[model samples]
Structures are given as structure tokens and as C-alpha cells.
Target: MQPIDPHSPGVMPSGLHASVVDQMGLAIGAGEWAAGSVMRIEELEERYGVSRSVIREVLRVLASMGMVESRRRVGVQVLPATEWNLYDRQVIRWRLASPGRVAQLRSLTELRTAVEPQAARLAALRAPVADASELMGLAGKLWAAGQDGDTELFLALDIQFHRLVLSSSGNEMFGKLNSLVAEVLTGRTHYSLMPEHPHDEALQLHVDVASAIQRRNPVDAHHSMLAIMERAMTEMSTLWDEAAHK
Candidate 1:
């Protein structure tokens, strides 16, 4: 997805510990450190040019995310990718950064396809009036940004629009996926996966979804959102094929 802004409020703190975590995470994700490969704490400390405590903390964080497991005598072993906490934002970011970026994007988009339409439907039925109004406003801004070829603004607005829809769904579980949606939208834009200028139809579909929610039309909202997801899949498929052939 999108590049995580280093200065962003909740981003990983900057320091040796974070650097070690990121480097090791990226290495593991890129298959440089294959699953089942082991690295001792002293080795990690030396590789990262950090101290034992920093290395230990990095492993602790990675272990919590299911990226690595530390054994009593075997050291830290990289786990299989299938065992990772896929929902963890850092893991998602690392995967997007790896050679598997395209596949990661495809998987996340598929997830959005499955989840967001229903979220839209629930938002149409349950969103507060204020939130519905805000979504409508964001939709209008998205259209403007898209038409103007303002990719940066469009990306931000698109993320916000989807995040609001998810949050307004009145399902706590759905609300928790805001980061997932943000990563998808961000990744699409940052990785050149999105168009220089968003398609007119895509912009209009966003408007349609917002309008349906504003009107409390659940059926229209569901279908409109589904249409959006279908278009994304089509666009991504074409781009992915082109990239593969290149």
C-alpha cells in the first residue's frame, strides 16, 4: 500500500530499535531470511550494529507479530509467512515493500472486495447523519481531485472516504479495519499502481456510494460499493499483467 509517512503520529518511533525491526522485517519478508532460518541475538546485534537489549526488543516485537520465534537454544527462527499476523500494519507494510508487493496488493484488495460492500450497506443504514454528510463532502473532494489529476490529494481523500464508511458501519469489527483500507489505498497510489488521473467512472462511483448512504439507501449503497470493488479488481489485474510482462 502507501508508504508510511515516517513523521506520522503513530508510526514506529525512530531509533536503533525501530531500524533493526524494520530491516529484519523487510529481510524476512523479502525471503532473504528464509522461514526456519535462525539468527542468534549476538549475530543480530552485530548485523544491526546495535546492542543486545535492542536486538532482544526487536525480536520481541517480531515474535509478537508472529514473524519470528525464539527458542531456548535454537535462537530466533523466521516463521513461515502464513503464520504472520497479516492484519498487523507493520507486517502489511513490510510485505508491500517486498518482492511480493503485487501479490500482497491483490490479496488485500480481495479482502476489501469481500468486506467493504457490506460495510457500505451497514453504513447506509446506520451511519450518523453527520458522518454521512462528511462522506458526501469527501466524495465531492475526491471527484475534484481526480478531475484535476491531483494524485496526492485524491489518495488522501480516497483513504478518508473509505475509512469513514468503515467506521460508520456500526460494526466494531468493521471499524477496526480502517488501517487496512488506508494501506490498500496508500499502496495503490505510492507504488504507481493507480492511474495518474483517476478514471471518471471510479470517481462517479464514489459519489454514488456517498449519495446512497446519505439517502439511507442500503441496496444502492451495497451495489455501488460492489461496483467500485469490481472496477478496482479489473484495473489492478490489467496493471499487474502489464507489469509482469514488462
Candidate 2:
């Protein structure tokens, strides 16, 4: 699907409501306007220079995402961060942008554990050997670079690992999620709310999974990838619990 352009002029056509909704959803998730913050329709209208209809359209989209509540006099009140829908694609993007994005990252990482091992297993069975080999090659490069402490090289290669995994999985739904995963994992400083991970465990896990895939060992690939996600979850759980307290 083509990305929606928010920069265009005039009353955004009704067709663009989904795009508008996604943008507003992201802003709210990013904590652009904090909890209890009033998002006056007229003000947003002036801000976006779009029709009240479009603004409402965006707000309604946000409402559906559990990002806000609308009432007569109370107007639009931004709710607590946790209230927002974390699963919706657009909601996930917004949460990735939040100031406290570490918690969101933790959540995403946790989800990866549940979904990706199965994805890897299926990919092993379904993906052509050549495609799996290519992905494993990229993972090898990523592992070496990560061990070298080359953040740039490590990130680029890490992205390849996911793209290849999704492609190998041959599942369109999970493939679409790659875009969201890519954005969150890359340029993470934009919405950093968590501490940077110490050590090189993530890199090593990538190597193990890559090796498993290269050897066509679906079970090992599955469990190895799952272990990587598990460690991340464990580290992030304490942070998430602390954030929830506040």
C-alpha cells in the first residue's frame, strides 16, 4: 500500500481518513499531547488546516485506537498511555514514538517471542532453501559487525534478518508487520524511553538463529530466536512495571 501524504493541501478527502487517523494515532501514542491534555477540535483544525470533518475523522480514528475520549464539554481528553490499543498497526507505530517507548519496545519484543519462533519454523518448512540461505548470509554479516561493535553495520544487517525472515515465512500478514518492526528498531533514539542494552547477547542470538536456518534446523532456529526475545522480555519487564507504577 502507498503511504499517506500528510503534507498535501486543502480539506483532506474522505478517502484519506485512514491516513489521517494513523497520523493522529501516532501523535497520541508518542505523547505529543500528554494525558488529560485537551485536543480542541478547532485548534487541531487550525493546526492541520483541514476541515472539522477531517479533524473529527482523525479523532474518531484515534478514539477507536483507544487513544482518546470525546465528550460534550470535556472535549477530547488524552487518556493514560496504557489505555491505547497496542496491537493495531497504527497504534503500534504511535507507541513506538512515545517518550516512554522502552515499555512499548518491551511489549513488542514480547510479542515477537510468541509469533516469530513459529514464523521461523514455518519459514524453514515453507521457504525455498536459496531464500533461507540468503537471509542466513545477512545474519552472519550482522553477527560479525555486532561483535565488532559497529552499531551502524549491526543495525543494517539486523534489518535484513527480519526482512529475510518475513520473506522466508511467506506470510503476508507477518511481512506487513516488518515495516513497523523496522521503524521501531531503527533510529530508536527518536522515542527512547529505555536504557540501551549492554553486552552482545542480541548479536550472538542472531548468529545462532542464522546458523540454525543455514543448517535447516527449524527447531533450533525456533527456540534460539525465542530465547533472544525471552531475554529482552525479562530485562524489560522490570522497567515496564516501574513505568506502570508512575
Candidate 3:
């Protein structure tokens, strides 16, 4: 696995413990440590040239993420993927960084497809006037950012735009997913999967979604949002294919 970049903003700076976590997370996610495989803390400490204390800390972090469990007599055992906190931002990032990145993106895209259109419809039906207005204004800013080729500004605005929609839906479950959605958007840009110029149609669809919500037209809002996800799926698939071949 490629080492996480130390200079990358938002990435954890590498240290004995951080490095161990990243390596072990990748190893487990990539199936290097199969489910139910037990690993001794003493062995890990010696293998990584770290103290038992550091190794224990790393295990604790992994356990919190539902990746492993400590048995009374047996060593730490890897958990099944179903047990993982897959929605945790750090877990999502680590999965994206691992070899199963294409599969991870595919799963996330399907999840977005299922949830976001409904979120858009709910926003149309439930958003207050001010919240609807905010969506429209954010849509304008996102379009301008894209047209100007402002990558950083566009990405930030894009994340905020979707986050606003999910929150405006007035559904607590949707609101909780804001960070996961942000991670997906950021992942595309971070992986160099984004086009140099944002797709013109996709930008227009954002405007359409905002307008539909502002008009309280749930049908249009749902369709427009679905269009956006459909386009993204196509783009992501193409990028994944290109990356796999390369």
C-alpha cells in the first residue's frame, strides 16, 4: 500500500502509532488479515519496533472502528467487514486509500443513489423558505466556481451545497450522513478523478435541483438529483477503469 502523504492536509501525520494504524488498517481491509485471524500484541510490538504500549493503543483505535476484538485468552481477532464502522470518515478514507478502492467507490455511489434523491425530494417538501433560498445561492456560487476553474473553491462549495440539502431535509438520519457525503466528494478530487473542467451539464443540474426545491416541486427535485448521481456514477466508473488499467 502507498504510504499516506505527510504533507496532505487533513491526513494524520505519520508516527510509530499512526503508521502502524494505517498499515494495519490497509492490511485488514485488503484481506491480509482475514476475519477471525488472531494477532498477538507482543508480536506486533516486536515486528514494528514499537513498545507494547504503542501497539495496545493502535489496537484500541482499531477496535473502536469495529475492525477487531480483544479476547480474554486468545489474541486480537479481525472482525468481519459487516462489523466495521464503514461510515466513519477515517475508515472510509482508509478504504479509499487501499487496493479495494474501486469496489468501495462503487458501493458508496449506490448508497448515494438510494439516499440523495429522497433527500432532495424531502428538501423540496420540508425546507423552510430561508433554507431553500440558501440552496439557490449556493448553487450559484458552485456554478461560478466551476466556470472559473477554481478547484479548491469548487470542491468546498460542492460539499457545502450537498450538506445543506441533506440537513435541510429535516431528517436526522440524512443529516448524520453529511460527513460521509463530504468524504465521497473530496475523494474524487483527491484521487485525481475529477476532470480539469467540471462537466457543464452536471453544473446545470445542480441549478435545476436548487430551483426545483425552491419551487417546492418534489418531483422535479427528485429527478434532477437523480440525474446528478447518474452522471457521477458514469464518471466514477470511467475513472476506476482507467486507474485499474494503469
Best-fitting candidate, scored by lDDT: 1
- In candidate 2, what are the lDDT values of residues 1-246, reduced to their tens digit? 987765555447656677667667767766688899988988988876677778876787778878889978889999886787666666666666666567668667766777788777767777888877787688668767766767666667767787778767878887777765676566353443324543467767777877777777889889888887776676567656776798
* TM-score, cand. 1: 0.93
Candidate 3 — worst ten consecutive residues by lDDT sum? 6-15
Model 2 has an lDDT value of 0.72
Regions of model 3 farther than 4 Å from truth: 1-23
Over the stretch 63-162, how does candidate 3's per-residue lDDT look in tens digits?
A: 9999999998988999998999999998898888877777888888899999999999999999999989999999999999999999999999999999
Clashes of each: 3, 0, 0
Local distance difference test values of all predictions, in order? 0.91, 0.72, 0.89
RMSD of each: 6.6, 6.3, 6.8
Cα lDDT tens digits, model 1, 188-222, are: 88898987788899999999999999999999999
What is the lDDT ranking, best to worst?
1, 3, 2
Cand. 1 Cα-lDDT = 0.91
Q: Pick the candidate with the highest TM-score.
A: 1
TM-score quality measure for candidate 2: 0.68
Residue 217 CA displacement from its true place in model 1, Å: 0.7
**Residue pairs in clash, model 3:** none
